[model samples]
Structures are given as C-alpha cells and as structure tokens.
Target: MDHFLTFSLLSLLLSFAAAGDFSDDQLIRQVVPEEEQSVNLLNADHHFSLFKAKFGKSYSDEKEHDYRFSVFKANLLRAKRNQLLDPSAEHGVTQFSDLTPTEFKQRYLGLKTPAFLESAQKAPILPTNNLPEDFDWRDKGAVTGVKNQGSCGSCWSFSTTGALEGAHFLATGELISLSEQQLVDCDHECDQDGVCDAGCNGGLMNTAFQYTVKAGGLQLEKDYPYTGRDGKCQFDKNKIAASVANYSVVSVDEDQIAANLVKNGPLAVGINAAWMQTYVKGVSCPYICSKNRLDHGVLLVGYGAAGYAPIRFKEKPYWIIKNSWGESWGEDGYYKICRGQTHDICGVDSMVSTVAAFQSTSE
Candidate 1:
C-alpha cells in the first residue's frame, strides 16, 4: 500500500510536469519572476490544474495546450500589472485565470451595442424625490441569478431578460428567471414600428422591449431555457408568462438614471465592456476603460463604494453591474464601474432603459 501510494503521487507529479512545455519551475519563473523558487512549482501546479479544468479535454491536445499556456502567461502579466499599477483599487480583476484572452473576448465580450436610437413613443417624465444615496434591486427581491450566455454573442437577449425579470418580480412579488433563448430566436424580426434586435449578432434593449410588447408576453426560463446558440423561433404563445405594458429609455443624465432605478427596478444598459475581459476586481474607470465606446449590454443592479488601504480612488463610488458570463467571471458574475461621474465611465449613462410590467392579478 505504501509503494502504491508513492507510485500514485509520482504519477500525479509527472502528469502535472508533463501538462506544459516548460518545467514547473521554469513556467512559474516566466510569469512571476519575483518568487522564482518559492512559487515555481506550487504556482505551476495550481495554474495547470485550473487551466485543465477550464479547457477540459483541450488541455491534453499539444497545440491547444501550448496556445492556452501562452494565454495563461499573458493573463498572469495582466494580473500583476493590475496589482502594481492600482493595488489600492477596490474592485480587483482576477476571475479570468482559467480562460485565455481570446476565449474570454469571444465568449463574454462580444456584445455589439449600437448607439441608442430615439424611441417614438413619448414617455412621461418620472418624478424624482428623496432618492437614496445607494440602492440595489437585489435587496428588494427583484434581481435574478447570475447567468451564463455560453459562446453566443447574445448579451442583448440576456440584458433584456434581466430587465424583464426585475420588472416582473417587482410587479408580481415573485422573482423568477426568464428566457434569453426566447429572445435570441424570436426577437430578431422587426417590430410593428420597424425596430428590431439583431439576435445573436447584436441588439438593443428598446427593440427587445418592442418585440416583447408585440409578442404579448415572454416565457419563463424553465419553459424555454437558454441554449446559447441561435435557432429557429419556437415561441409558443400559450407559454407566455410575463409581459410589459411599455418601456422607456432614461435620459443620459446620471441623476435621472438613478431616480429611475429607485422608482423602477433594474435597468438594461450598454457600455464599453472591452477592458472588462481581464478585470478580476477594481473600480473600472476612464483610466482603463472608455467612456464613449458602448459595445456590451448589461443589467445595472445597484451602486456602492469599493475601497481598500493605500487609497487609489478613496471610497471610490461605483455602479454594481450584473453580467451574464456565469458567476465564475467577475465579483461573482458582477462588475463595478467607477460611478458618480457626470458623463459616466464606460457609457453607463448612454443607453439605460426600464420596462414596466403589468401588475399580475395575484399581486
């Protein structure tokens, strides 16, 4: 039994060493030069295990292994830089150790958010009075679970579903997950007013709202679970579970957006989700992200401060953003963008909208 145990340990060590082109010591030294001897083997083993878990069978393929190793090296450098440059940052970005930059970009950062278009339906101005300094719809039992969009560039659908879910919950007092797949398949075609979502390619929240209004309702996720990839629209009118009365785009004013959140539930918003690919944690701001380049759709859930010692941006105000890249991504499937700016960072104030669901009879 002792010999067998020794053999098993030897095999495991060999397996770990053979997983990469470089020796464990060499691989660790390549990325983390400071701890050449201390972490050389341990870091290598830990990273190899993480990489294998992330890529699964692909980790065994020589070519894929080499490529992912390269990416892993790059990610290590990115993490180190983030730590050195903004060590005091409240939100630190380290959740992407498993995915290569290429995989991360293609899988999560592919949302193509277009410029906000004017909605023909005029919305009544919402009154703003005694808005809280901080708020989160999740606390009100309106937000749903953090979801995964798989390999599809269907962030639009996910954003739509999140917004609708919040609205439905607020209106009915029952929090439920809605279907992004339904929108991915059905919300592509133009609405009565000619507005349309681009399906997996890209889309807008307002257009998705129009599609839902016209379709009469949307199905719960249980009835139409997300498949990631697009397919033929198989929507069944009978399965309709949630419908909105109408939707309205909030003004570009940050204060107004906050007021809308306080009055409404969660919001569907667009922003430049570029730098977020490697973001593990930190208050993402204009320093690392653009304020105008809106490219990804996400749900705006709340706002708060994230601060640590050494104080990079002391008590830095930030918006709590819920993403659809599974809970393993950032801050447990959420991100914090530097907030309180008049113009905002990552265009958070650009294309914000909230739909109003008709109150359920049970409510």
Candidate 2:
C-alpha cells in the first residue's frame, strides 16, 4: 500500500509537468496559419531561442503557477503569430535584436538619463506630501488591463484612458473601467488613425486628458470595446460620464513618499521599462529586459521602505499600476517597479489627482 501511494504521487507530479508542456514547433503551429507556417518557422525558432535564453532557466517548479504557464504559452503564441503576419516587421527582433549586446545592457538595465535631473531643472519646487495611510483610492476597484497596441504605437491612448479611469473613480467614488477603444475611435483632435499620429512612436498623457475633458468625458468599456487599429469615431452618449478633471504629475522623495502614503492614494508616473529585468519577487537589479527605448507608461500607487530596499506597491509600497497589456499580464493586470532607486524612474515621487478634499485644496 505504501509503495502504491508513492507511485501515485510521482504520477501526479509527472502529469502536472506534462500538462503544462509545450515546444517551439508546437507553439508555431498553433499561432501561425498553415499557409505561412513554413516561411515563418525560422523566425519562430529565432524568437523562441531568444525567449529561452532570457527566461528559460528562470521558471522552476517552485515558481510554476498556472498563470505563469498561461502567460508563457500566450506570449510564445503571440510571437509566432506576429512573425507569420508581419515577417518583415523589424521592430520585435531586429529593432531590439540589432542592438549590440552591450548597447542592450546599457539601454535596459543601466540608467543613462540622470534621475530627477530633468524634472528638477524645470518644475517649481513643491512641498513633499505623503499619501494617506487609509487612502481608499487604490481600492477604488479592479481595472481591466489592455493589450500592447503592438506596432500600432498607441501607448498615449492607453496611458490616457488608464489614468482617466482611476481619476474618474477617485472623483465620483465609483469605479468604472473605461474604454480605450472609445478614445481611439472618437479622438480626432490628434492626428490620423486616432493613435495621435502613426509614427508608431509615443505620446503624452496630458494631451489625452485634455481631449477627454473637452469631449465631456468618455464611455465605459462595455459600450465601446477595443477593436484593435483605429476605426471611425463613434460616441455612445449613454455610456459617457459627466466630467473628468485634468490629470496632474507629482514628484516626491523617500520621506515625502512615506508622508504621502498617509495623505493620498495611487499616483501615475512614467516608468523607464528599459531596466525591467525578471519581475520575480525578491530579485534585485541586473535587469535583462530590452533596452531599445522606454516606450511604455504605467501608474504608481504607493511606496514602502520595508524590504532590504524600498519597493513601490501599486497596492502597497508597490504602487498598484495599471498596464495597457490586458489582464493576463503581470501581477493580475499591472506591474510593479522597484522604488528607492532614488532615480524616481518608477515615478515614486510622481503624483496623480485624488477625490480627497486635500488634493482639491492643493490644486
């Protein structure tokens, strides 16, 4: 009986491993249409190799969670499909791959731009205020994460809607996961494709905020779901909110961040994703993510000095940030950038508007 029980346990472990199993070929076949499978196999292999080199050893039994497996498989499938659909697409591999390994290291992990140097030179000095200890802003409610605009380069829209959704909740005391699709379709104030111009480049959140406020707020996600690339402007009046305030940026230091912890809630800030190494908990620097350009934006919620070093909590010390890349990625729907780096790369010192009377008075 004892032998049988041990064998059963071993078999269970084996089945679990096999259930999560996948290979480069299988991923390619699953993602790429049959017609283009052969033509894209090499590219698929190259992408797979790169992914393995970067993250293969990182995943072990101890860290094997269902979501982790799902993300891995999903990303692999995405890469395969991307390769087939846009074989000539230079952004994913060449754009990022062409970088000399050294350049890649410098771009992602090393901090080239001096921290707070640019902001300090221009912005007026403001008193450092901490977030409220019991601030309910972070708990406003769940936000639906979004997919990367991919080569479309509509990060500005995502950032704008992400911040606006939170601000809307903070002001109204009701959480509404608004739609980026509405902004993409209706916002013509910007350039073509409603992507704020098709440079596949970058944009500012301030512009998006202005567009929303002038347009009398936005619609909920249900009314106008994401339809990928830009489509004709469509406004659903019933889904519109009454109003939305202009978003703001704040800068604080360690002490001030702590104080603000007792004052406000989450704050949105531009994160330099160039240095995002493995995001596994307890892992410090030596980042291995791409160094191309810091093209992404995220929210910063709170800060903490708890760990050996301070960690930014989107929900705690880690500021609960909302990512544009759908709910399937990162800590549920967001990612956490480590704080205390003093560079404020994670926008630890940055600020966002809240519903609190204090924030209104300060404004």
Candidate 3:
C-alpha cells in the first residue's frame, strides 16, 4: 500500500512536468495558498483588520517558502561568504554606504543630487570591479527572461549564470548564450534534491567561473534547454567550450563611474531592493517611494551625460542599468539609477566586475 502511494505521487509529478503544468512559482502558489491569498487581499482589502488577517496567513505560508529558499540561498552565499570572510582571502566585501548619496553623486555624477542622497551614502559597497566598457556591454538581448528556481532557492545560480552570459559576450566577443541548466544540473557543492538550499542560497560569479573552467564550459540554449526544473545530471561532452575569467571587484564614486563609462563600458553593481521596493514603477522621485530599503542587484551599462540636463533626477546624473527580468521590465530591460543621490539608494558608488583589461583602461 505504501509503495502504491509513493508510485501514485511520482506519477502525478511526472504528469505535471510532462504537461508543463508545474512552474516554480506556480508550485509554490499551489502548495502555499497564503502567497496567492496575500496578493489577493492586498488588491482587495481596505480596512486594517482584514489586512492584518490576510497578512498573518501570508506570513505563515511565506515562512515555509522562505525556509526552503533560505536553505538553497545559504549554500551559495555560504561559500561566497566564506571566501569573502576569509582573512587570507584576496578579496573582501566593501561597504560604501557611509558616504552620503549626494557625495557619491558629486564625486561620480558631476552633478548635485537631491537631498536624499545624503542618507543613501550609508549603504555598503562590495569589493568588485566587474563593470565592462560601454561598447562592450550588450543590451539584455533576447534572453532577459526571469526564471523561477522552484522549491529550490538557487537564485545564486540564476544570478551567477545571468551575469556570466553577459560577461562572456563582453570578454570573448562571443555572443553565445550559455546555460544556467548546466550549473543547476552539475554543481554539487550542496544538496542533490535539485532544490538548492543553504548549501546553495546565494553564490558569487567566481564559483560559476571556476565551474565553467574546471568543467570546460557550458552548452548553448538549444543543446541543453532549460526544463524549468532540475533533473538528473546529463553531461553532454559535445556542449563544452572555452573557460571564462576569474572575476574581481572595484569600488568607485558616481563621477568615477561616468568617467569609466566614457573611458570603458558597462559594470555590474549590487543594490538593496527590499521587499517593498519590488515595485519598479512610480519611482520618479527618490524619497517619495514608500520603500527606502534596498536588496536587489543589477548591472550598470551607460550614463546619459549629453545635454544641459546631462544628469537625470533633477539635480543628479543617471546611469543606465540592465536587469535580468526580460525586456518587459524597467524602461525596456533597462532603468536609470540616480547617481550620487543622498544615500546611494541606487548604488551610485558601488562595486562592479569587469575584465582586467577593461579595468586597467578605466584606472
């Protein structure tokens, strides 16, 4: 009887995968009713009591998902953290939030930012010089789609691979889109359930680079297509290619960033996009937005320093950023961060990763 029940569950899961009915987010929605309910309630509720009730239930469900994702993110973050935390480690995490956003802007944007820039300067800046040159940075292209990692919190893999795809083009002049599926399928530094957990929470680009180099490289999308979920590791020897470079970080002011763009190309920067800041629209004014906390990461590609109003945001300059979420998002796969704002809300002065050659030129 027990065996029959196990077989029945397996059959159901297989059927769902075969029919493409189960997506990561969808699976969470199905298993965790509170997520859907919270969104629904948010759209519906007006009174406090109702909101509280709905929020409580949502929180309950979110905890379960968060726990699951935490485990996955932990795996990746832990390794990267260990590397960053190691006293002997060559690289260390830099915190650049101490400088008011205005100071960062004035130094980098060559313009005075809104008063809010003062507060944003306190955010942390990691040590990384991963930004590339303007011509080198490609548009997000046709692959800006966002994928859900399912019960797994392997956002580290998605984020790492996403940046690598861009970095590969900038470095090798190869516009080939590599595979995230390869990392998901092969990386065994963590669990094998296909759900990346604490063993795989958040990862750095370095790990991905190491994996590619050691394993030879990854295949094109067509060769190792994403199943939207993890499966048995199927290594296709023919899919191998050249390896990528080991990434490094560099911190710069907003002015330095613009100067770098004029001299080099694009760069990757980390920003704090807390839960509330998830809404990307209606952010015309910096402080006006409800959420002031940051928690997300993005890449800065170019700066609009053309006319009399060379900068964006009234008194501050703006830098163009490429995001992972396909072209459907943020000013067509791009958005502008008010450089040198009062508090670095947009990460005006942050860490970026680019090729060593590009770094030498920028310096």
Candidate 4:
C-alpha cells in the first residue's frame, strides 16, 4: 500500500508538469490568432522569458498556481480583441500585458473603499452653459508635462497638483508643476485610514485640496520633487509657489462639468478604473467598463468626440484625461474616456474638485 501511494503522488506530479508546458508552439499558435502570432520563434521565446522573469514565475511543485501562463495568454488575446473590436478603439500590450489581471490590479489599484466627501467647505453653485464641441488645456499652455507616480498610490496628490497647476497658470500666466511629494509626505489627516490620499495607499482629491489650503500653500515640483514614497514632510514655507484660496465641489450634472472644464481650466476627478487598468485606448463607457464608484483620481483637461491616432477611425465623444503614469502609457500619458449623456462616465462628474489658486493669498 505504501509503494502504491508513493507511485500515485509521482504520477500526479508528472501530469502537472506536462500540463504546465507553455513552451509548446502549437499551444501558443492555438491561443494567439495565426495572423497575430509572431513569425520569429526566437522573439516569442524572448518575450515569454522576460515575462516569466518579470513576474517571478516558477514551475516548482510548491508553487500552487497556473505555471502554464494561461492567464497571461488570455489577457494578450483580450487585448487583441479590444483592438480588433473597435479597430479605432483604445488598448495595446505594454509591460503590464504580461501580468495576470490579479497581479496587475494588486500592483496598481490601491485606492481604499468608502468614498470621501466631495469637499469640507461649499461655495455658491455656478450657472452652466453649452461648452464647445472640443477643448484641451494643453493647447492653452495651462498644462504641464505628464508625470509618473511609479509603484506608489499617490494618484490623489498628482491629480490635486495638476488642478492647482492649471489654475495657477490661468491666474498668473505661468505654468508650474507643483509638488506631489509634498502632499505624499505632508498632507495631514489625509494620511488617516487611507480614506483619502493616504500616502501611497490612497486618498481623496477633496481631502488633498483641503490639506493644501491648511498647509498655507504647496511648493513647486522643482523644489520639493516627488519620491513616490512616504517620507517626513519636508515642506518649506518659503519655497511655496502657489496657494489655494479655496476649492469647489461641482454638481453631478454633466453640463456643469463641461462648463467647469472650460472655465476652470482643469478639474480633478475620481473614477472606477477597473477597465482602465488594461485600457489601451478608445471611448470608455458603461458598456465596456464599470459606471459609478471611483477608485482612481485623475485630471480632466478637456472633452471631445475626436479621437487620437490608431483609434481615430470615427468621432466618439470622450473625456481628455491626463494621467501620472508616465508618457509610455495610454496616448502619451493621456486617456480618452467616453463622454456625453446625463449619467456620469465612470463617476467622473461625481467627485470633481477645482481649486482656486493665486500667487498671493491672505491666511
């Protein structure tokens, strides 16, 4: 009986090892459409090796997971479908394409649950009007170069700084990149419970704006810089470049959001980024992505129906969003989410905050 049990175990191990073989050329060809399959076997092997190394994948018996790279192949196939479906739609393979969905979300989506309040203080409501068919803050020189947050979940700070930078530009005729690191290290109470912009864990843009007002002002990126990690607050009052007089919570109305985008320069917004994690390009909407529930913060610089290259087959209305994940992602560090209609797109109009910045302000 003991001999039989040992043999059974050995046979099971052998079966698993055989099933884990992702090296079979036929298997690769079966998963990836023949037309899309790489003609060079060596190139395919290189990508597979690099992917395995990057994710620290091992085929050891102790590793109780799909060592066959099934998830990785599925995602690549999904990306291909996304591209083919829209043709002009958004999506492509990047460093993230090789990662399993679970790994991708774990490494990137760090926003905490329980939504933060829109704003602690409220201002008078603003009247709304029809905004132009298209507009971009970058065209007006009110926007700064794209930024990357690295592995840190400091997107709230980046979003806040982008809004303040654009506001300051429109107010002082000067475009300046503010310090996200300052907020990461210093934004007080905001670090509490990770409810709103909690260091690298996550935090709210509204909470961040409030912290900026209390901190007197924020330093320029050139002065404080971003380390993408939590550290001691190195804020220097003298190095303060811009001050937020106050911030307003725009109404949930899409028309108001449009008006605010044109009048206020850029607005910081939160969205449900589940689909955006693997998003390559195209007009993102409720059909293809989740609606309501915002887990990521970004800046809305403009909105229009005109799409960008490769995905510009037709005019589909979308929000011109600026991300801090470097220029390598999306359309040069920018993404176009679907726009228009009454309901909010990914809850973008849900938690919008625009700060009023000035070079000089009285405490």
Candidate 5:
C-alpha cells in the first residue's frame, strides 16, 4: 500500500515537472493538505452555515445536508492547502463550497483537448518591445460585463464569444454582448480524434472559433441570449452582431500573448481551474498546477504587475483573466494567475487564440 501511494505521488510530480518549470516539486507543491501552516485554521461549521445562507443551498433532507456539510468541511481543508500553495492569493469558502472536487469540475470546467487544425492560421509575430507596463481590455471599453455560466460545462462557448466580442468591438468601436447559447446549441463539429465541441459536456476554444467562422458569426446577447443549458439551435444569420473575418492562434510565449492582447483584443485561453473552485480574490499563483491538463476556458483580458508588494521584480507578473462565472467569483468575475510569472501557468499561455479580424458591421 505504501509503495502504491509513493508511485502515485511520483507520477503526479512527474506530470507537473514535464512543463520544465520546476525540478523539485516538494519546494512548491503542497502534497499534504494538513501540513503545519502559519495561518489560522478557519471555523468550518461557521463558514459552512454562512455558505449555505449566502448561496441559498438547500438540500432535500437532513441526510443530504449532512453529506454536503461534510463536503464543505473537506473543501475548507482543501482551501487551506490552496491558500498555502498560493500564498499571494486569498482562498476560502465559495458558492461551490458544498460541492466535491469532481462535482465542481463536472459542472464548471468545459474545455476539451484542442483539435489540431489542418489549416489553422498562426498569429503573426508582433513587436513587444514597446508594450505598456499595464494593459486591460476592460479599461478600453472593449470587454463586456461579466456573465454567468451557471451549472453548465459550457465555459468554452463563453470564452469563444468573449474573444469575438472584443474583436468586434475593436473593429467597429462598439461593445455588444455576444451569445454563448448560439454556440452551445449549434456547434457540434468533431475532430478526427472524435473530440467535439459538446454543448455542456466539454469543448475547446479553438474549435468554437472554427465553428464561429463556419456559422457566419454570432448574435448579440440580447438577440440570442444565454440559457446555460443545451437546447435547439435558434441561430439567425441576419442577427450576427459579431462575425469573424479571420482568427489566429498566438504563440506560447508570454510577451507575444500580451502583445496580441494589446494589439488585437482579448485572447481566448484555457486554464486549469482546480484552485479556482475555492478562490476568493487577490492574485492566484499556485506552484503545482498542471499546465497540459487545462480544463476550463477563459479570456486573457490584460497583464499587469503591481500591488501586495514592490511593483518591480520583487513579485511575479500577474495576468488578468475574465471568467464566465459571474461577478460573484474572484475579482468581479475575473481571475488573476501568476505562473511563477511565466506564460504557461495552468496552460493559459498554451492554447491561446483570438479573432484577428471581424467582418465589417455598421451600426
């Protein structure tokens, strides 16, 4: 039994090490959740009650309530470990405090393995030497308000539309909320490996981009709206508020990703949302996140370096991400991750894609 446990841990460590960021997993990875910590342990019962009342979480019976309470307690411990591993960020009970990790991943995460395209266009290399010290699409009136994905695994659709929304805004100088429901109900394209852009099951951002191109673009949120569930396709070709003229995949380099974000628009990227389940706020920079196993799709809004410490090299650079979980989570429906200040933390920098141009649409 001890040998099996050791082997399992070694395999997990090797998975994390494959990204070529760290040689010693023990130095940053928190394998044991109950390890001694410098911070105060949270009052589980008190927090659990508060979580229930805040989220309006009511179970059918006492048995289910007890089960959920136990899950919430376990999540508190997990949050402590996350807090320790990501000391730069705040971690605690969230709306999903009652859910187990599997439940959370099932309902929230929705990114599948990116499909290799036969003719996928690569984003042209842009100059990054004169990039600004801080950049955010929200500040430029390019990004729309944060929306919710509910209990559906349709985050990829939201991420796909988000990049297009920004691209459309940059092209037409109009910020219009696009539709995720359009993609959720419509896009069912499959790759050679059988990986598809499933509605609520899971999907990839690049695949959704491909679908958007073939479908003649997407409608506005007010025109199509989002239901957060699978439904019949009610697409209207005449109501395409944002149409993709062309799209391209950015390189894995961090500076280039930022350059694309600044020059083009918000870039759609994938991320490992394991730590995000209990994330409260601040900047999340975990030391032991899987870079290759990205499960959730989000938008790369901007990048900045400041707060919590000296603004210079003393702290790792942080990227601002726009999540689809509504304004109740993280920094007003956004997440910040510092990949040891790298571009590939949680695989955010790996599968980056953006709409290079949008078909001209006049007001």
Candidate 6:
C-alpha cells in the first residue's frame, strides 16, 4: 500500500511538471532549490524594506504594515515563479507589489472590449519591402514623453490619444501631448455588447476614436488636463487641438502591423497585462500568456531587435509598447513583448488599430 501511494504521488508530480501548472504559487515554489529558497526567504524582508523606500510606500499603522509585509512576501514568491516561467525577462517587486492581483487589475487596467470590432475602417495594405530592422517614432520627433494615468482605469483613453498624437505629429510636425481627460469626461459611446465607455470604469479605443470623429476633435492637455478621476465633461469645441479624419483596424499580420506603424503612426492595441504587475525590465515573453484575455490598452510606438541577427525573425525582434503607468514602471513606461513565428504573444497583434487620417492645430 505504501508502494502504491508512492507511485501515485510520483505520477502526479510528473503530470504537474509536464503541464506547467501555475494554479498555485506554492506548487511553483517547489521549483526553487531548497538552498536558494532559504536565501530568498532570508532576503525577502530586506527586499521589502528597499521596495518601500524606493516606491515611497508606507502603512498608516502597525496592523496595516504587518498585512502589507505578508502581501509583499507573497509577491516575492510570485516574482520567483514568474522569473522561472519567463527566463529571458526580469520580474521582481514593483510599485504594485503591495496590491492584490484583483485590486491591481481593477485599479490599473481598464480596457472593455466591444462585442463586434466592425466599427473602424480597415487600413490599406502598405508595402512591407525594405522595412527597417529597428524603427522608433520617438527618434523621428513624434512620440511624447511618458505620462501616468494615475489610479484611474482610463488606460483606454491614453491609448486612443497616443495614437492620435502620433498621427497629428506626422501631419503638422508638432508632437503635442493630447488630453486623456477629454475622453474620460465627455465621450461615452457604447457598442453592441452594451459595454460603454464609463470614464474611469473602462472603455475601448475604437469607440473612443468614433467619439473623437463625432465630437469634432479633442482639446489640449493644458486646457483639459487629467485629474485621474471621473468628472463632468468640459470639452471646448472651439479649442480643438487635433481631429481624427478616420481610424482603421490593422491586419493580424505582424509585418503589416510593422508597416502601419512605420507609415501611419503609433498603433493602439490591447494586451492581457497579467504578468505586467511584477514585470520590471527585459523583454516580457511569458511561457503561458493568454492571447484573447486582453485587459489593458497601450500604444505601439516602435519595434526593435535584440541579440543575434543572422537568425532573425521571431528569435530577435520585439514590439515596443508605450504604457500609461508612468515613467517609474517597466522600461520607463514602456514594454517589449517578443514576436512569435505565428499569430501573437498576448493579443498585442490581435486587436490592433491605427489612425488612418487626421489634422492637428498648432500651439
């Protein structure tokens, strides 16, 4: 009976190893070496101390501090598990380490998908021949500096404005920082799914674009600044800084997505952002990220290749995603997700859209 039990336990372990089960953090903790686990535990308190200092985090009282400490330790173990799953990338304590995964998702991510994506026009197929090995819109004087969306779930607004800002720059040679607050306050369009743009609650970029076209245009950031909260609409149509002529959806093809970025401007995209909580740096290409469960919206400003080149394609190239989580986050509010040989690596290439035509007013 002891032999039988031992055999069953061995089979279970092998099955878990083969399946790459991450259902429980403790299960993955077993992957760490015993000596290394001890070292990690010993250093966890030290790491948490540094994290609090670096991020300027503090608890109100002893009880809160104790609770936060326990949460931080759990995050450290989670980071270890993530590091193993994504060996090429680095994962550790972040500003969001203290928050539970559910809280983080609710506070930071705010992308609500429409039932059907048939609203936007389809972009024309641009030539992909002679595409640069590395391309960045920032160097070309298009992309604005990184901006934080605060604790608001207004990421969809940022994504929409980022694409429009790039389009405006290409048209008028002016890289103006547009207003995300405008979308958050004024526009509230709903799709067939009945999921409407509810300010800080959540929204979709395509619907925001539609609202932009209908509302005539968007105002400047200085005029309608972000307050990081939902408020009454203060859109001044007379102070329209930029207008979207039309927006279009891009093909799922990576080469075409590159073509759109190079020719049109930055592309607005949706991503899962599941592992982004603990992500600090390096290219984030996790072993198990769902491509359909996109929860956050971001702008695709550029793409580059790192390491070897002779064996190009998926092995080297990566997409540069401009996030709205402030400059203190991953790669200065930017994320590099690896390119796969086939479809996508976390819906980055799935729900892609870009500004087809636009007009911008001068300062």
Write the residue-wise lDDT of candidate 2 on 1-363 in tens digits. Answer: 134533553464445446665432233344344543333333654554565465333445645533343444444434334443222111132223323334334332211121222222222234554334333335546233444544344555666665565555555556556666766666645423243422223444444555666677777767777765667778866557535544443435544544433344343354544322223233222111212234445554444443333222322233445555444334444555444442444333443322121111111
Where is the poorest 10-residue window by lDDT in model 6? 307-316
- Scored by Cα lDDT, where does model 3 land? 0.39
lDDT of 1 by residue, 1-363 (tens): 134533543465455456755432233233333532131333754676665665453555778777666666666655554443233343223445556655665665544544445543534566667777778888889998899887777887888889888888888888888888898888875544554576666667777887888898788888888888778888988878889888887877777887788778899988876556656665665233345567688999998744332344356677889998888777788987777642566578877888889754321
Per-residue lDDT value at 301 in model 1 = 92
Residue 92, candidate 2: alpha-carbon lDDT:
32
Choose 2 or 6, whichever is better by TM-score.
6
Highest lDDT scorer = 6
The TM-score between candidate 6 and the true structure equals: 0.88
Candidate 6, residues 69-142: lDDT per residue as tens digits? 88888787778767755555788889999987788989999999752356567888989998999999988988
Q: Give the CA lDDT, 0 to 100, for residue 270 in model 1.
A: 89
lDDT of 5 by residue, 1-363 (tens): 144544554566567667456522242344442343333436667777788888888899999989998888777767766765566788888888888888998999988985345567899999989999888889999988999999999999988888988988888888888899998999997765778988999887777888877887888889888888999999988887778888888888888888899999999888888789989987776656768678899999998866362212256678999999989888889898884355577777888887855754534
What overall lDDT goes with each candidate model?
A: 0.69, 0.43, 0.39, 0.70, 0.80, 0.82
**Candidate 1 weakest lDDT stretch, 10 residues:** 32-41
RMSD of each: 12.0, 15.8, 20.3, 11.8, 5.2, 5.5
**TM-score, predicted candidate 1 vs. hidden true structure:** 0.78
RMSD (Cα, Å) of candidate 1? 12.0
lDDT of 5 at 129: 96
**Winner of 1 and 6 under TM-score:** 6
For model 6, the superposed segments whose C-alpha errors exceed 4 Å read 1-39, 307-315, 361-363
lDDT winner between candidates 2 and 6:
6
Query: Which residue ranges in model 5 land beyond 4 Å of their true spot?
Result: 1-30, 33-42, 115-118, 309-313, 359-363
What digit string (tens of lDDT, one per residue) describes model 4 on residues 60-169?
66233354445555666656544432344465555566566566655555555554563355544666655687889999999999998887888878888999999998
